[model samples]
Target: MTLQNDLQSALGFLNQGKFKQALKQSKGGMKRHKSHPDFPNIAGISLSGLGKHRDAIPYFKKALALAPGFHDARKNLAQTLLFLQQGEPAMKLLERVLKDQPGDQAALYLQAQAHLVMNAPEAAIVTATAALARDPRQPRMLRLRATAWNTLGDEKAALADYQAAVKVNPNDADALQNASLLLARLMRQDEATETARKAVAVAPQNVEARRRLASQLISNGDSAAARGQCLALMELDPKDTQVLEMLARISSRDQNAELLPVAQKALKAAAPRSLDRANVSFALARIADQAGDKEAFAAHNDEANACMAAQTPYDYEGSERQFSRIMAAFPDVITPAETAPEGPRPIYVVGMPRSGTTLTETVIGLHPDVFPLGERGVPAFLLHPCLDKDQDFTPEAARDFTADDISRLPEMPKGTRAYVDKMPDNYRLLGHLGTAYPDAQFVHLCRDPRDVALSIWRGYFSGSSLTYAYDLKAMAHRFNLYGRLMQHWRQVMPGRIYDLRYETFVADIEGESRKLADFCGLTWVEDMAHPERHEGQVLTLSNTQVRQTAHTRSIGKWEKYADVLAPFIDGLNPEIWPEIKG
Candidate 1:
């Protein structure tokens, strides 16, 4: 065959994704037409397509050597270098290409990717924005810019760009998946679930999309659907430890015996000291607990916690100092603002994780006049500049909140008297909340330290914020810090904060719920006592638990593992839990 015919055949094979065939055709063309840059460039493209990125580098270099001004070969080499994580060298080559062809969108997109690889998210945003300006319908550029925004912690901007990308290209499963995650994080459960469903429909075989859909289904209290998704995932990869863990989480007592053996197999296959191993161990612990085998439960629970602790060690002293600063910052009572911000009243439910915060919110949400906004980070996000820095927070920071800050809060439904913000970590931000909103009411949930610690240890937390939860000693220290901080708030804001003990609340649901309702200015209704009947979505770890009728089964649950929790029990400060005796 002639040189042109061979090159055309190779190009056609490359376009058809037949990488080996393309490589063979291009190799034959190179032998016939020696020193042809196009032949070497096409060979490099085929090699890169076949995942031989290292081997592709030398061919691109040869093409560039034969024709020094071959921009396509230079761009191809730059991309291969990026795949190899050599961002600096790749960046230099892209700059040269852009210098030669200033309006090349392909080079610009790759340059943005190189910026991301270099950890320069701001620079990536600039490059992506320029490309997007020229072509607003470019979904790739939109998604790239969205990623840069997410890296800079601007979730709203990231979400907007992601949604825009999906609008431009409806079948983009990756953009749909990312948008769904942002929606879930923003406490929009129904929307998140819907978006996840679209993603799964667009890419039926995508494991991550299926997993995301299952997680959203679980959050929305659809356990049966989540189990079905897990089963599908198992069919895709029978040995997937994550799928096994999800099955274990949503399994019923009757299903525990059936799932236990599968979870054990996954544990044996998991890597030592890895997150997957930790998750499998947690699953085994759950199975054992359901089967009423306390010894096995303790063994697996301890193993899971040990693996997590090795991965993320807590900074106890640093946390102690932070808590101390928070306490010192609010030495005196924060009087309500002279003019309360006019809008729906906010009921702040604050406590440690697994302290019945979700349960309390569920009961309150049963009132027709209340809207449940689950676990919003708006308060923390707005106050982060003041509180999360090296400097100590001052009373002046509270007064600095403006109309724009209040406008950023989630909108309330029509005719709603109040909304609940049930983020448990808001215990640390009571002073800011109280000073900013005159109509805001704080309800503090308190549970036994031992129960809370054990629950946290067994739970799978996703972020660095809860690193203290994996270790018994760190949990105890954090419990003490929380106790002291709550005491400070009580002393400073007398009559402003309501303390609701989980045990007490569960014992007399109607009577205690009546007081809670009255405190929040809601009329007494029978539905308030039956939170299980509430139709709103729950997006917390207690999603499934809160759907069941209120019970005291969880109270004093740590007693069953008393022998295993001896170290944790000894670490607790007596001052914090005067109820516990030696």
Candidate 2:
């Protein structure tokens, strides 16, 4: 074939995604035309298409060497560098391309991506916005800007851009998935689930889309559908440990004995002390627990916790120091604000994880006048930044959490007397929140430390913030800190805080729920006692549990595992629980 014919043939193959054929043709052309820039450029493009980014670099450089002003080769080289996460070098090359061709949308989009990879979301927003200005219908640019907006914590703006991107391309699974997450974050669970379904519908073969849909389904209490999604995911990647773990969770919840052997198989195949092992171990623990095999449950739970502790060791001393600082910062009684902030009053449900906070919030939300905002980070997000260098709460910090900051929270429905913020860790921020919202009521859920510790140990928490949950000693230390802080809050803010014992609340659901509703200044209703009847999403680890009727089954759950949790029980501070024999 002629030189031109060879180049055209290679280009055609590359355009059709026949990367191997393109590479062969391009190599043949390069043998005949040793100094041709197009041949090397085509070869580089083909190599990149074949996911050989490293190998493509030399060819792109050779093309650039033969033709110094080769914008296409330079752009291609920048993209390959980005694929390798070499953001700085990729950025410089893109800058050169944009300098030569200022209106190149392709280069602009890549520039935005490079900015994101380098952790410069603000720069990415600017670059992506400029590209979108040229064509508002560009879904890629819209999605890129939405990601930047999300990185900057502007969920509303992020949602808007994502929706715009979806409007431009209804089949854009990425935009749909992201929009669903933001929607869920904004307390719109139904919309989030629908959006996730749309994403799965459009990208049936996409594992991530399917996984997200399964998560939404699980959160929405559709376990059957979630299991179907998990089955599909298993078909997609039979060895995916995450899929196995997810299936195990669903199977445990449904008491599907068929998956017990599958989970065991995954556990055996997983690497020792690895996250995959840890996840599968947790799953196996759940299955064992469901099957009423105490020995197997203990063995699997111990292995899971051990693996997790190895991966993420807790800083007990650092946490103790932080607790000390928090206590010292609020040494004196904080008088509640005289005038309540002009918005929906907030009922803060604060406690340790698995301490009945979600149950309390669900019960409160059953009241017609209350809306549940599950585990919002707004209080900490607003207050932590205002803390003094010593990490002390300041009057200035209270003033800093102004009307504007309150606006960041989800809006309550009309006639709502108060909104529930059931973020358990917000207990640490009560000193600031109590001083900011005059009408705020604090419902502190107190569970038996043994039961709390057991529950926490049995479950897998996602973030580094909960590293303490993986070890017995760390759990005891954290419980002590929580106890100390709660005592301080009780002394400093007397009437504003309501201590609700989880056992007491569950035993007398109606009677205690009345007091809780009254404490929040909401008129007591019979519905408040039946949280299970409330048809709203529960998006916590205890989501499934909260959907069931209140039960005392978990009240003294630690008794069953007392022998296994001896260290944890012994480490508990007796002073915090005088009723228990340590």
Candidate 3:
């Protein structure tokens, strides 16, 4: 064949996804036409297609060296760098390509991807928007833009972009799955379920597709359908720990004794030190508890805790030091009138994990004038950047918050009197929050330390922020720190915080609900007692418990596990012991 024909044949194979055939043709062409960069670039593309990203890099570099002005070769090199996780170099090269050829859609798309990886969603949005402007119908660019919107917490924008992506590429399983998950989070379960079904239909053999379908079904409270998906997933890969974990959760939810054997098998087969082993052990413990095998339950529970503690050791002293710094920094608290930031004042529902944060947020959110923002880190993000952690936050330093810091907060929706931030751990941020939004209403949830400790210990937490929760000593110490912090807040700003005891709230929902509404400057309404009536996803471990009517079944649950919680009781503060124990 002529050189031109050889190139055309190689290009056809590459475009058809016949990587091996393309590689063979390209290699033969490279030997015959040693000076051409296209053959080398094609060879790199084939190697990359075969998952040899590192091996592909040298060929890409060779192509770029031979033809410095070849935009295709440079773009190919950038993509290969991105595939190999060399993000900085990839981004620099992509920026160079875009600088030279201002409307290169491929370079813009890859630059957007690089920004997403770097956690710069704003930058990603800019690049992705530019790409879409150049070629408005590109499904990948639409999906990339959707991701940037999602990361920016603009779900409506993300949903619109995802819808556009699916319209452009109906068979895009990832777009379908993302749209479904977002819909689920937005509490549009029916639409989410349909979208997830479409994803599974499009990619029946894809484990992630099945997993997402199962997740959507779980959110929709369709355990039977979710279990079927889990079983199908198990058939595809029985040893998949995530599938096993999902099966265990579904079986536990249904209280199905028949599935106990699956949990046992998973526990026995999991590696001794793996997080999966710990999770499976916890599942077995719950099953054992249900079976009335107290000893077996305790053993499994302890093993799981030990595994978790090993994996994520608590920094108790460091936490104490940080708390002390916060306390000393803001010793003299300013009154609500001193700081001046306008808009609907924030109501922070702060407490320990498994405390009444979700319940409190739900009840308060029921009020007509209140909007629930639901567990945002915005306050912390703003406040932390101003704090010089090494230096104490003196009254002078506390006054350092400028209007620009406050302006970063978005305006509340029209007619909303206030918005609630229900981050449970915001208990630790009360002092800093007071400095930023002195007029901010604080609703602090105080639960029985024993119940709180037990609940936290038994639950599955995903982040390092709660590393102390898995061990009784760490939990008790953390609780002690919490108590000290609360006491400091009360001392510094007397009568400023509305203390909502969980037991009192649970026992007299209507009365506490009315009083809380009064505290938040709202008139009493009967609807305040039915938090479950409110819309929006609850994204905490308390999600299941919060959806039901207010009940006292969990009031003294730690009593049943008293023997297991002896250490927690002993380690708790002597002054607070009576109230917690009773």
Output the worst ten-in-a-row residue range by lDDT, candidate 1.
390-399
Off by over 4 Å in 1: 1-93, 114-123, 152-156, 185-188, 335-338, 391-408
Please report the candidate that would top TM-score against the real structure. Answer: 2
Error of 3 at 22 (Å): 7.0
Candidate 2: where is the Cα deviation over 4 Å?
9-13, 16-32, 38-59, 252-255, 317-321, 335-339, 383-400, 574-582
| Model 3: residues with Cα > 4 Å off, grouped in runs | 1-52, 65-73, 118-120, 149-172, 179-237, 252-255, 302-325, 337-345, 368-373, 387-416, 435-439, 530-536, 559-582
- All-Cα superposition RMSD per candidate: 3.5, 3.0, 4.7
Please write out the lDDT profile of model 1 over residues 1-582, one tens digit for every residue. Answer: 887798899999999999999999999998998888998899999999999999999999999999999999999999999999889999999999999898899899999999999999999999999888888998999999999987766677889999999999999999999999888876677788999999999998999999999988998899999999999998988878878888888989888688777888888888888888988998898898888888888889889888888899999878887787777667888777777767788899999999999999999988989888888766776677656574544445555553545555554568988888899999988987887788889999988878887788778777777888888888878888888899999998888899998999999999999999988888989999998997656777898989899999988888877777777788888887777744
Write candidate 2's Cα lDDT for 485-548 as tens digits: 8989999998889999999999999999998888888889999889888677777788799889
In terms of lDDT, model 1 sits at 0.86
For residues 135-167, what per-residue lDDT tens digits would candidate 3 score against the true structure?
889988999999888776667678889989999
lDDT for position 10 in model 1:
91
Q: Rate residue 409 of model 1 by lDDT.
A: 54
Give residue 412's lDDT in candidate 2 (0 to 100): 62
Model 3 scores a C-alpha lDDT of 0.80
